[model samples]
Target: MHERQDVRTILNRTTNTVASIRFHLILVAILAFPLISGCQNLKPLPDGLSLQGGEFPSSEVAFIADTSWIDENGQRQVEQALFDDLFRIIDKAQEVIVLDMFLYNDFQGPVPETTRPLAGELTNALIDKKKQQPDMLIVVITDPVNELYGGLQSPYFEQLEQAGIRVVVTDLRKLHDSNAVYSFFWRLLFKPFGNSAANTLPNPIGAGCVSIRSYLELLNFKANHRKVLIADHGSTYVGFVSSANPHDGSSAHRNAAIRFTGEAVADLLQSENAVLELSGHAPVEIDIPRDHVNATTSVQVVTEGKIEDVVLAEINRAAVGDKLDLMMFYLSDREVIAALKQAHERGAKLRLLLDPNKDAFGREKNGIPNRPVAHELTAAGIPIRWCSSMGEQCHSKMLLAQDDTGRNVIVTGSANFTRRNLDDYNLETDVVVRGHHSDSVFVAAHEYFEESWKNTDDRIYSLPYERYEDRSFWRRRLYRFMEWSGISTF
Candidate 1:
């Protein structure tokens, strides 16, 4: 009996040792996967990006916005011109139309009121254009979230595909990992299983159910968050970069865009070709006939990490007597926050209009990074205001800086001021417009901002910073943790 007991003990010890070895093997694989898979060494960025193009006439660049506000009777009203311009550009397309939008689905949960059918409209617009010009090269590039990471079919994407439009879903795996700790396990374990169109679990974003793999992929927190439109119009090419998406849930959100036609469009196309190349799509070669102008304004295409570089350089250059106005949906990038403070300290007048981080479709959210960051900025004597969002968000991402000499610089596009968006983890695109303050684009941008800042025409566009002041110590720490950890979406 003693010998039998000793044999049993030895067998149990061997079993425990095997389990320990297996655990360590997994740990080592997780630690080494990012390097072996080249996940951290992301695909090379497009070469032509961040290059300043030859100056075009200020008339060629237009500032468009979609504004939502409340009246004295507390009624929500929306005035939109951005999409109208976008559709008009689409109608004028004759040869090629390339649209790369982040969110292109109409996925709204149970909501009380009817939202604009932006997804259907955009789909119909593209389909109709395809039917009108059967030979037109219409390409639609979007993210996988619209399809729930292949856990479901996007009706809009199907319609676009049926209409002979080449829809390219961006390969998110080619991008750097935003949530590294979570992504390592996901790549090693879950990613190989691949997502299915089977619906076994309830969808987190909208109605209906989706596979669990969808949720697993969502934990990565990375995306191709670019909203760009390029099409040939008349004799030249036109391009648009905006913060707007054609998703119905975001239809009423305030957004901004810049539309231009010039040498800049070539740079924009080149940058987009890089996306195609990285995503395994054939690169498009379009020979844009550049036209000469009086060099009234300089427009440049800046994407991904280049956006951060340009924005920081502009903010750091803000000296005394310069005025900087920023309207952003998210503001949690530590470097940007510190730069703003330094700019203010150098006597640069700064006015910040930020979304209150309160609404997500029909859901209510606790004000996070925005609220805490606002608290920090207000303490530095920099004035801040909260967009009085009733249910929709103030989703504009723009910065307008004007020097005392009437030189103006406006940077606007799909990027939010968050670590995930600015740090090269997620894909993004933005344009920098350098011109005189009197330029039409600058004037329109200033008027758009002033209308909201001053609450012109009895429209309550924004509330004072005190409306959503977050003074809780714990919440502030939580905000920093989430930002650093990339655990929460900004």
Candidate 2:
């Protein structure tokens, strides 16, 4: 009888304690509801409006394209013009080389391949540069996804480090998480316990699956998407800003870049200082060559939202009889859409080449941002063409505009036309080249857009949007939600 009474007493006390704790938690949540709701109000970072993008020197520019396709003979052929330019710069660097690229890996996953050993080639180029100039400062900056959010080992980065190159992985934790809902739970449950566990699970991104712990960490989904190479060109500084990654899986994608030598070379170094300093590197002493204004083209290296502003300014300046062209991997920015629509309404001829957003590394995508945007544009009477992406992306961010005054402008570099990419969320760079219509880059810009749209030379580059048209109501809602809520992976 005595033992039974004691057991009853203990049970009652335990129940009371749990109830008390639960009541307190509920009260706390109620009291903190406003703060939780206001979590989306993240403080903004320093945007590029105040940043400096220098003037054009007496410099020359190059138009580089890497095209992959099935030829008339049904054989895989790739016309690589970017890598040659990259290696050419690496080979001639006399002082320092600062490279900030988003992806560098051999993780082909389930994507198609080219014969090119892209990752190895880039690693070798950097290593060779270091060997040639033993004291030259060579630094590399990349994203954490390349580490699979702490899953697989990065042999490429390790090789660079071993060769005395400084490699800094951007501290993602320092950046704001755009997905507020996932971020709330992540902060409460996942981040503190160490999301990366033992290496027993399969790496979802590697060619041959490797060890990992969780795929949950990857759901966070932000990246350092800038691709920049700044090195010495003769006695002056040269900059290469592009949409290309050294990832082997992406070797076959149609990509473009701009190489320029001028005062903007120092500006490129200055702009990258934000990334390097954010990643905990020391300050850089940019020994820039004096300005000798290049008459060929007026070049400026713009970063972040400044790219968006410049692109819009150039397009919006179009009068009747002008032309506006765009080719990009993803297109969902509302501002850009509005500008394109306005340009079309104002009688500027518009052509857009966009990815179908359909396939990614063996997995199918629902065509989030692009499809709905495409549908909207098509309804607005804008002509759109979808890239015939074999197993990769139409990973190019370019816009060519010819104003009424005959000023030809092309915006080309690493930025994709997305909210996350251009709105200060990711580090990005692009060179704005303004020249005469006869300039080489200006001419090539128009020709590239035309070739992709027309398929003139008995080659298939793009398909009509009707073939991949997605007009589902729910998908449009989902895309808008993802794009506006900052929960997208673009």
Candidate 3:
């Protein structure tokens, strides 16, 4: 009995030692993975995009939610002028039509809006274009999230495929996994087991249809969150970079886009084609006409890791008398926060129009990282405002900095200023536009922020920062930890 007791104690000690070593090893891996992945060089865009020109004519458009303003006596209203602008471009396409939208389904979830049938309108437009110009190259590139990451089949994709359009579903595995807490085990243990062959559960997006495998795949928090539309109309090409998603539920959201016509359009197209190539699709031919517009402004299409690099560079360059205007859905990225602080110290007039970080699909959000981050920024004397929104989010990811020397730079696109959105984890696209206020596009972008900020014309799009400020230390730490860990929806 004495011998047996000694043996049991020895075994218990050995088990504890093994457990400790395993825990330490996991901690080391978690710490090193992001650094290792981030250190590597970003993959290059497809060779097809080499024809992009640098100078182009560009215009800006916006959708302001003017419903909740006190000046409006009767009912609230949302000015959704973006879709019509999109339609104008689609109607004028003569040769090639390339669209890479992140959300293109009919899943509105809890607070469904009477959104225009944007999906059908876009589909019919594409189908009509294909019918009219059979030889015209119509390519539709989209993320796999439309099909809930392959748990369900998207009839929208099927329809486009049937219409003979080159539909390329981005292979998400090609991009970095932002939520790697479970991705390691998922890729090894579960992915091998495979997924359900048929749709088996209710769709989480409220489509009344989903599968177990869909939920399983969704646990991998990564996506191609870029929203761009490129139309090459023979001698001229126009591209739009914006936060607006054609998804019905997103129609009510306050969003913005820049309609640029020139060599930059081809560059945007090039970025999309690169995704197609890396996603294992065959190369499609893109015609490049020698096109350069007479304009003082220049535009560049930054994709993948370059988007983060360019945006940070713009922020870091801010100086005294320069104005930094930011309006975003989420802003939990430490790097950006640090940059903004540095810019503020340098005497740059800073204005932040932030989403309250509350409300999602009719569900109340505690304003996780944004509110806490806002509290930190607001304490530092940076004037902030909470976007007055109903069901839709103030989903625009935009930043503008103008120097006293009449130099202005605008950075806007689908990427939120969050770790997951900006850390080269999820695929993103942002256009960096440079010009003076004299440029119409530049003027429109400047006016959009100021109007929304000051509530011009009695349109209440935002409120003071004190309304949703949260200064709890624990919440701030929680947000920072989540962001650092890369476990975030933004």
Prediction 2 TM-score vs. true: 0.91
Alpha-carbon RMSD, each predicted model: 2.1, 2.8, 4.6
Candidate 2, residues 123-213, lDDT tens digits: the string is 9999998998999999898888788776666899999999999998876655556565666556555677664434566677774343333
* Candidate 2 C-alpha error for residue 267, in Å: 1.4
Better of 2 and 3 by lDDT: 2
Q: Find the 10 residues in a row with the least total lDDT in model 2.
A: 43-52
List TM-score per model, in order: 0.95, 0.91, 0.87
Query: Order of candidates by lDDT, top first?
Result: 1, 2, 3
Candidate 1 lDDT (Cα, whole model)? 0.88
* Model 3 residue 405 lDDT score: 90
**Candidate 3 local lDDT, 344-460, one digit each (tens):** 998889999998978776677879878998988887889999887766678888898888999888888888888787766677788878888777777777778877788756567
lDDT for each residue of candidate 1 in 99-213, tens digit (9 for 90 to 100)? 9999998888556335588989999999999999999999998899999999989988888899999999988886777787788778878999999877689998887899989
- Superposed Cα RMSD, model 2: 2.8
Over 4 Å off in model 2, which ranges? 1-13, 26-41, 44-52, 73-76, 193-197, 207-214, 290-296
- State the lDDT at 488 in candidate 2: 79
